[model samples]
Target: MAEPEDKTRRAPLDAVGRFTATEAVAAALSLIWLVAVAAYSFTAPDGTGPLGIVMTLMMVFLPIALIWVTVTTLRSVQELRAEATRLQSAVESMRNAYVTTQVQPSVQRKLEEIERTAKQAETALATFTSRRDASLVVASADRKAAMAAPARAAPAEDQPALALGTPAEDLRAPLSVGDFIRALQFPESPEDKDGFRALRLALEDRAVAKLIRAAQDVLTLLSQEGIFMDDLKPERARPELWRSFAQGERGRGISGLGGIRDRSSLALTAGRMREDPIFRDAAHHFLRTFDRTFAEFEKTATDAELVDLADTRTARAFMLFGRVAGVFD
Candidate 1:
């Protein structure tokens, strides 16, 4: 009875195996049919049987149709891949930008705070230095006074006090045309090409001679009007102007014509005169002369004459003034 039961189980197992094997064989045969159809359609020549001709035509038509479907499938897959890559890159870029934007403001604020603190410190240092210098001057004055008292007592009979000499005239005068030309010849850099050209043209123009004469006349008139009262008074002339003049002079060593060689220098000088009470009165006198001179010159001058004037020495001087005033530089 047990043997019969075992035989029943074995029979069912055998049937299941047979069914699986049959299905596998059928699937393989279907694949072989598809392959054979494809190969036969492609390899078959023309002018054969009607069935063979039909198969050949089908082969041609079928491949074209299949190619489109294959290409579409491949293109879809490529598009999906590209889209995925773009999305990933965009997400990464956005994350980086967000991080940078969030961090930058705090850094900028700290930098600003540091700069403000540095400026405050500089101001405090300058103030302290000024006060210290003033104290030193006061102490020196006291020492001189104490020494003068003893000298005065002995000066009547035994020792004669030395007479003080007048202040020495500056040996180095204001820049001359020759000096300006020389400076242009040896400019500090290639950037001075335009300036060199302008200067050269002005030097060649006879109108520049007239312009210089006019400028000198203007200067004389200003002096006569007492606008230059402080030209004789060292105390009245601000140290700043002298310093600027000195710097301009020094710049001549490198470029020959310093910042003071331009039109802005003339304007600055005029502005300074305006600020001074005595100079302002003198400037008014010169202003009238300037207006009259300029009007006459303009009225008499044609465009050609004006161009000639621009090409002269006076124009070069004007250009120099402009450069000094920071307009050109």
Candidate 2:
């Protein structure tokens, strides 16, 4: 086929190889002409005999050899130009990659420096605010003392016994912020102590106990849904993370929850509390109890052995879940 012939075609490396091939062709032609001339001279002793024949053949073959050389030279030039273009493109690509590599670290360092500066500014602001708050507290105490001194001295002997704020008479009664504030005040006398005892007794009522049981049921439900109390703690310190978890984007804030496993269970449990009648009533009761109790509860009671009842993990969960469900609204 023509393909095999094309592959096997002679290609000269340089002008020297072309010249050598041309000379070889000329030498072969000259030898043939001499042989022809010798035979003709013997036949006719004066011979212009083969001279015309040799010149005609030379004219015909020389041009063919020149044309072959010109074509090969043009093909080689095209191949060289193609290789150069490819090399230029590769070099451009490498330059872009090198620039990206060189710039990344400096950009990253600049970003880190900005973050550090922002943190330092936040720390300074926090310190200044704390100092300002402390000074204001001291000044307010001084103002109160100055205003109350005369009135306090005259009424010290005649003042009636102070009373402690107790739980409301009705379990479902809505409590006000002012009622809670008054309840959180320190017990100052035997009468106040008696009031706190009565309040504590009232908190043990069956209806209030049902609220605690309801909170426990919620905890159990979450357990079945594959969420746990320990899992909620780390989130407690982070408001946004906790918010995400409560919003049904459970896996968004917890990396472990991102796995496909437990995904379906979480989906099934997401709004079940709101949908189920039993859980809905329990949630309502728990929220009502929590709101009224939290209002009347003393913040300092968390550390007190007798009144540390509301400081448990279960109680904390109720408060957190109540907030997320808009129960305290």
Candidate 3:
């Protein structure tokens, strides 16, 4: 079945046939007039008054006959022009329909696949994160028990009591695999009670603040790179960063509200992008980068490094972990 847009722009096939018929009739009449004129000139008997008179009379009426033929020809031309206008309008409408609707099905399918893969990746990362967190808790308990053990009563200065373990520093350490997965599963939002306020307080700590900034920067970079590839014109991509920032300022607008509204725009944009060779190439590049960054994060972050993470390097390491888990939020 034709889409509504297609139906709106579709021209009847008989329009062309009608236009051709009009042209053919005009041509045939012109040819017949030419043949009659030629035949009369050759077949008329010399010096025969009746024949000469008849031929003369025919010649006299020729202008009127030509006038009628001219009118018919003009009418055919007008009809042909109207038909051509209709066809052109239909063609333009079809072009719009093709760009807006027909080109999007494949892109929509691919986006759905990406969403599925992202969900699976998030699930796997969540599992790994839970296990890592459990391990940390167990390890901390063991350390506490060892430290709490009694020492033998002995003369002063004979031997020093075993040093007790201090609380593991930086309890809210940089995100681990599990933390990253959690963030992806439940993205941080101001909508959650005290979520934004708590985040701000966390940022007061130099370590957490730096890590948060790094994560934001990484997302910005990825978004910029994607825009760069899609929009070859520097001016077009230049404003993209501002668009992202504006989305944050506006508090998610349509997408942040969590509804189908965002999907409609996304689908439309994806369809347009798919039709653009430059955008498609850029999208593939961005996808590859996403995959590579994930691999690096999964391989490089260790439990020990996650515990005492303090510097920008550690923050970047955590950001990488989050990226791999597809929890850029």
Per-residue alpha-carbon lDDT of candidate 2 for residues 1-329, written as tens digits (9 for 90 to 100): 45563211223233335545545665676566667755765686452568966865565556556665765676577556656666776788899999999999999999989966865565455334432233323322112211111123343666665565533443333322222222222133567864354334333444344444566567666676576544442111222222233344432243321222233443444476657877566656665665444433322111121122322444455544554454333
RMSD (Cα, Å) of model 1: 26.3
Determine which window of 10 residues in candidate 2 has minimal summed lDDT.
141-150
* Per-model lDDT: 0.42, 0.45, 0.42
Residue pairs in clash, model 2: none
Error of 2 at 126 (Å): 4.8
Candidate 1 residue-wise lDDT at 311: 32
Candidate whose TM-score is highest: 3
Q: Return whichever of 2 and 3 wins on TM-score.
A: 3
lDDT of 3 by residue, 199-309 (tens): 454354443344355444444443543421112111111122223322332232312212112333345435644575654444444434433333333233332322212
Q: What are the TM-scores, per candidate, against the unseen true structure? A: 0.26, 0.30, 0.33
User: Roughly what TM-score does model 2 have, to 2 decimal places?
Assistant: 0.30
Which stretches in model 3 have alpha-carbon errors above 4 Å?
1-59, 63-89, 92-113, 118-187, 194-329
Alpha carbon lDDT of residue 46, candidate 2? 50
* Clashes in predicted model 3: 1
Regions of candidate 1 where Cα sits further than 4 Å from its true position: 1-35, 38-71, 94-101, 124-329
